[model samples]
Target: MNSDEIKTGEERPTRNKWNLILGILFLAYGSYRLYQKLQIPDDDNFGMILAVGFIFFGIYDLWKYYKGV
Candidate 1:
């Protein structure tokens, strides 16, 4: 194969559809859970903390996709 036949890095890469879908799903679910958790009066509940973690993870995933990283 000739060198010219190889693809160059000049072309823009396509993002995965699944990544976008999962990111949105995670973000939405986490937000919803967080809202629910906040309504509870229990201070010992760790649900909110876990929910926030999910939200951050989702945000990071979305950011990676958006930045083409």
Candidate 2:
């Protein structure tokens, strides 16, 4: 209750914004990688896997943001 004391975590306002931000970033990066994969012929599929993974996580983050969890 002291004037100089900082607010506790529970007393602070919630700002759950990183989820949306990371979601957008991840989606963009995934889409770009996917496009590159489609444009190029490669012997390795690892890049494709990574691209899909990014897309999946992106969607999950977006979902979390919307669900307010």
Candidate 3:
């Protein structure tokens, strides 16, 4: 293959690694927020929603990683 035709298949793994890392971070943060929400009484307004949103986003990232997207 010519130099110009040489393709490095490294981007996918790098991208996936980043996605996985970010996904885990988001998931952890979400879980922590959820725990905090449970610990705090009479504050069941937006914290739960935010936690769920973050968890969903993390799951999406994992899905994307699996799909190689």
Collision count for each candidate, in order: 0, 0, 0
Please provide, for model 2 over 1-69, each residue's C-alpha lDDT reduced to its tens digit, 9 standing for 90 to 100: 786597556554344699999999999999999999989888659999999999999998988887777
lDDT of 1: 0.83
Candidates 2 and 3, the one with greater TM-score? 2
Residue range 1-69, candidate 1, lDDT tens digits? 999899778867677766678789889999999998888887845788899988998898788777666
lDDT of 3 by residue, 1-68 (tens): 69778887755543468788888888899989888888889668787999989989998897777767
Q: Candidate 3, which segments miss by more than 4 Å at Cα? A: 1-15
lDDT of each: 0.83, 0.86, 0.82
For each candidate in turn, the TM-score is 0.75, 0.76, 0.71
How far residue 50's Cα lies from its native spot in candidate 1, in Å, is 0.6
Candidate 1 is scored at a TM of: 0.75
Q: lDDT order of candidates, best first?
A: 2, 1, 3
In order of TM-score, best first, we have 2, 1, 3
What is the alpha-carbon lDDT of model 3 when measured against the actual structure? 0.82
lDDT of 2 at 36: 96
Give the C-alpha miss distance for residue 31 in model 2, angstroms.
Answer: 0.6
